[model samples]
Target chain A: MIWKYICGSASSPLSVSFSERPRDGQVIFNSGVYLIGVKSGLLALSARCPHLGCQLAYNAADRRFQCPCHGSQFSLKGHRLKGPAKKEMTVLELRQDHECEGYKVIF
Target chain B: MQQTADYGQQTTDNNHGQRTTDNGPRTNYGQLALWAFHVALLTGVILSFHYRPWGDVFKSVSKISGWLPYGDFLRKLHYLAGQCFLILSFAHVLEHFLKETYRRIRPKEWSRLVLLFSLGFPLLFTGFILKGDKEGILAGEVMYHLAQEIPLIGSGLARMLLRPGEEFFLLPYLYHTVILPLTVIFLLDRHTRRLLPRGDWGWPFMAFLALLATFFPLPPDIPPYMEISHISGPWFFHGVQLLLRQVPPLWAGVIWPVIPLLLTALLPFAPPKLSKWGKRLTMAAWLIHGMILVAAWL
Candidate 1:
C-alpha cells in the first residue's frame, strides 16, 4: 500500500492543447516530456540524453538540444548530432485528442 | 624479506603505540578523516529520518531545509563532514605519498586505502544527487548513463546503483544511508586497524563542523528551467566533465578516471623504479586534472 502510494498509480497519457499549432523550432515541456514543434509535426521527446542520461535542455538560439553532462547535442528533430550520446533522443507516441483540441502524449 | 620487515615495523609504529608525537598533532590526518566519516555517518542517520526518497524529492528536501527545526543544521553538517572526510583522506594519502611511506604499507592494506578513497567519490556523488535539485537530478541521470557505458553489465550496474522509480531517489538513498556507510566503516576499520577514532581530533573537528554548519547552510536548489550549461558537477567531477566535452564517453567517462586510480593501485605492488614512475604519472595526472577543472570552471 505504501509503495503504491509513494510510486503513484500507473500514469495516464497527458493531453496538451494549443490555441494554434506550435511554431516551428518551438519546444514545450509537459508532464516530464518535451514536445518540439517541427515541420514534420510535434515531436514528443524524452528530456533524457541517449548517451549518458543527463537532462537535456533545448537551445532556442541554436535550435538544438544540449546535454550539460557530457556535452551531447541533438537536432531540433531529436537527431543525435555530437558528443557521447550514441542514439537519437527517445520519441514518445503522440495521438490526436478527440475531446481536447491538442494531442495525447503517451509517456 | 627486508621489505616485509620494514613494513611490519612501520605498521607497528603507525598503528600501535604513541599515536601522538612531540611535534605532530595528537591525531594524524588518517585518524581525523575517519573521525570525519563518523560524523558524516551520524549526521546522515539523523537526516535520513526526515528525508523522503519518493515523490517530489526536491520539495521534500526543501521542507527539511526550511521547515524542520535544526534539520538544516544536521543536513549541512552531514555535507560538510562528508567533504572533510574526503579532503582529509586526500591529505593523509598526500602525506604518505610525499614521505614515500605508502610503499612501506603491505600491498593488501595499501590497496584497501586506495579502494576506500575511490569509493568516496560515488558515496558523496550519490548524496549530492539525493538533494534533488536541478543539478542533482540531472547529475543522477548522468551517473545512470555513465554506468550503462560499462558494456555487458552496464545496464544492470546502472539499475543496481540507481533503480528507476520515483524521482530516481530510492536506490541512491539506499546506497547513501545504508550500504555505503557500512562499507566505508568496514574499510576504515581494516585500514586504521582501530575500532574507535582517537578522541583528540574527533571532538575538535565535530565542534568545527557544528560551527561551520550553524553559519553556513547549503545553497538553494535551482529549478530545471534555469540555464544549466554553466553549471558543473561536484568539485572532483569538474575535470572529467571538461574531458567529456573533448573525448568520447568511453574515454572520458571510463578510461580517463581509471588511469589515475590504476596508477595509485600499482604504487604498493611495483618495484622501486616502477613505483617511482607510477608516483610521477599519478602526480602528473592530478596536475592535468587540476588544469582541466580550472578550464571547466572558466
Candidate 2:
C-alpha cells in the first residue's frame, strides 16, 4: 500500500536509529499530529485532546500534550495522565519513505 | 333600638371611607407604562413577521417601513412605545429614589428595579444594532472590541457573546427581540404587582397610546453607507460613548458602567445602620451619572 507523505524527514526530530531513546516531535500537517520516537519505532498521535476536542499543544517541559480549552494532560505515548478527558489520544500509523527521505503518516 | 341602628350605620360608613382612603386615586404613569409595554410588544411581533435579522437587515427594515400597507405605522408605534416605556420607567425609578422607597421597607424590591433599569439600556443598544445600518454595525464592532479589551477572559467572553464572521448580527437580534423583552416582561410583572395590586386603567391607556401612535409616527432614519465617526449611540448610551472617548476601554466600557449598577443592586441589602449613607451614596452615583450624561450631550 502506498503511504501518503505527511511531514518532511526534518520535521520529526526523533531518529529512526534503534539505539536512541524515545523523544516527542510535533508535526503540523493535517489538524495536528504528534510523533513519538520510541525504542520500538515511531508512533503518531492526533493532537486533539479527547476531552473537549480542543487542539492539544505539546509541552516540551513536561514531555506531554496539554489541552488549552480544559486542562487534560497526556503522556508522550498518548496515555491519559490527567483529564477531564476520559480517553487517550488517537494514534496514527507512520511509515518511512526512502525516496522523499521523510516519514509519511498513514491516516 | 333606634340609637343602636344609627350606630351600626355610622360604623359601616366609616369602614367604606377607610377603604377609599387606602386605595387612593389612580395615576396615569403606571397605566401609561403598561399600555406602552403592550403596544411595543404587539408592534414588535408584527414587525418580526417581515424582519430578518441577518443578510441585509437594513434593507429588510426599509422594505417593511417604506412598502407594505400600515407597515410604517406599525414600525413607528413599536419605536414610539419603546421610547415611552423607557421614559416612564426612568421617571418611576427617579420617583422611587427621591422617595427613598427601597430603604425603609423593601430593599430587595429596589434591587430588582435597579436590575431591570440597568438591563434596559443594553436592550436598547442591542435593538439599535439590530437595524444593521452602518452606524449600527459600527456600534457592534465597538462593542466587540470593547469586550475583547476586558482583562483575563476577555477574548473568550467576547467569542461567546458575539458570533464570528458575517453572521455576527444574530446574537444582538436574538437579544433585542426575544431574550430582553421576555426578561423585561418577567421583571415588569413583579415590579408592577409590588407597586399596584390591580391595574384597572388598561383600556383607556391603550386608547391613549393608539392616539399618540397615529399623531406622531416615528420616521425611519436613512441607513448610512459608510461608518460615520461622529455617530453616537442612542441618547441613553451617549455618556458611555463619551466616557469611552476619554478613558480606557476597560474603565469606561466595563468598570464605570458596572460600578453604579452594582451599587444600585446592592442598595437594598445595605446594613440598616448604613442605610442613610447608602441612600446618599445612591443619590451621589445617580448625580454623577446625570453629570456624565449632560457632559456627553454638551
Candidate 3:
C-alpha cells in the first residue's frame, strides 16, 4: 500500500497520478522527476528520464534534478529549464496537512 | 520599403466586400510538424515502458508484464502514436514538397537535410528489433549483419555490439527513438521558422496523441524477435532499410532521402515544364518507394 502523508501546507499542481507503476517493460513514458519546493523542505524526484529510462537525482545546490547518464537537469519546481531533458518534470502534489511534519514524497 | 497591397485582393471582389483585419503573422508550420513529431515521441516514450527491448524476452506477454506502470495501455498508446507519427511526417513532407517549399531554400540550407538519415527507416528498424520475437530476431540479425559489412569499423564493432545473432536491442531502441530524434529535432531547429500560436496542448498533445494512439492501430504480430530471414520494418521505413541491404547504407539511408530536396530547392531555375517533370518525379519516387515496400513484405 502507498503510504499517504500530507506535505507542508499548500498542496497544488495535481500530482497524484504520477505515482502509479506499470506492468513494466516498454511502454510510453513521459517519465520525469518532480523538483518540489515546499515550506517544509527539499526532496528528490522519482520520475525516470525520458531519454532512456534513467533515474534522476535532485541537486539541491542547483535546485534541480539531474540525470546521471544523460546529465539532464530540472529545477526545484519540476520545470525543465534545461536540456538533455526537453520535457518538463512530472509533478506529485505536495499535500500540506497540519499533522504532517516533514516534506514527504510518494513515488 | 514600398508596400504594394494587392488591390485585386480587395473584399469588394468577394462575399465580405471589406478589408478584413484577420490577417496576422503566420506561424511556423515546422513547429506544428515538430509537435506532430513529438506526438509520436510521446507515444514511443510510453510504449518503451512496456516493450521488452530484447528479442528473447518478448516470447510471452507475461514475460514483459509488471515491468511498466500501466504498461498495457501505454504500450498500445505508444504504438498508435508512432503510427501516427509515421503518417504525419510523411504527409508533412509530401505537402511541403507539393507546395514547393524547397524552392525558397538555397542549396546550403537544403543540403543539411542529408544528415536526417532518412525519415522513418532507422527509427522503425530499431523499433521492430526491440520487439523480442521471431520477427524481431531476424530483423536484429539483418541489422547486425548489415552493420557487419563495414570495413575496419564494421566487423569488430558489429560482433561486439550486436551479440552475434541479436540486434543491439535496447541500446538501438533508446538511441533511435529518444536520443536520435532529439538530435534531429535540434538540428531541424536551425533551419526552421518561429513558433505558431496554437492550443496550449500543441506541445502537450504529444501525450494526447499517445492517448489517441490507442484508437487506431495496425494488427501487430507477436514480437518478431527470433529470426526474420525476410522481415520488414513499418512500411514507411522499410523502403529505406531494404535499400541498405543492397545499395549500401550511405546510398539508401543517407544520401537518397536528401537528393530530392536538394534538387527541389534548386528546381525554381529548372524551367516551368521541368517543375512539371519534377512533380511527376516526386510521384514516381513515392510510387517506387511504395512498390519497394510491398515487394519486401511479400
Best by lDDT: 1
- lDDT by residue (B52-116, candidate 2, tens digit) is 97777889888887896888778777877787777766665666566555554355566777777
State the lDDT of candidate 1 residue by residue for A34-102, as single tens digits: 777788887778788877677787787888889877788999778999887778998877766655456
Q: Give per-residue lDDT, candidate 3, residue A88.
A: 67
Query: Which portions of model 3 show Cα errors greater than 4 Å?
Result: A1-107, B1-32, B46-56, B59-69, B111-117, B148-167, B193-212, B216-218, B221-232, B237-283, B294-298
Predicted complex 3: CAPRI docking category: incorrect
DockQ of every predicted complex: 0.53, 0.02, 0.01
**By summed lDDT, which 10 consecutive residues of candidate 2 chain B come out lowest?**
B1-10
How does candidate 2 score on lDDT? Answer: 0.65
For model 2 the local lDDT of residue B141 reads 63
- Backbone atom clashes (below 3 Å) for every candidate: 0, 0, 44
Record all residue pairs in model 1 with backbone atoms less than 3 Å apart, i.e. clashing.
none
**Candidate 2 lDDT for residue B206:** 63
B126-222 per-residue lDDT for model 3 (tens digits): 6665666544544555555545555677778666545632344756666666777777676555444222224344656665665564565534655
Q: Ranking by lDDT, best first?
A: 1, 2, 3
Residue-wise C-alpha lDDT for candidate 3, range A2-84, written one tens digit per residue: 43332323444322232222222211122233434344443334555443233455554564566543355666555776544
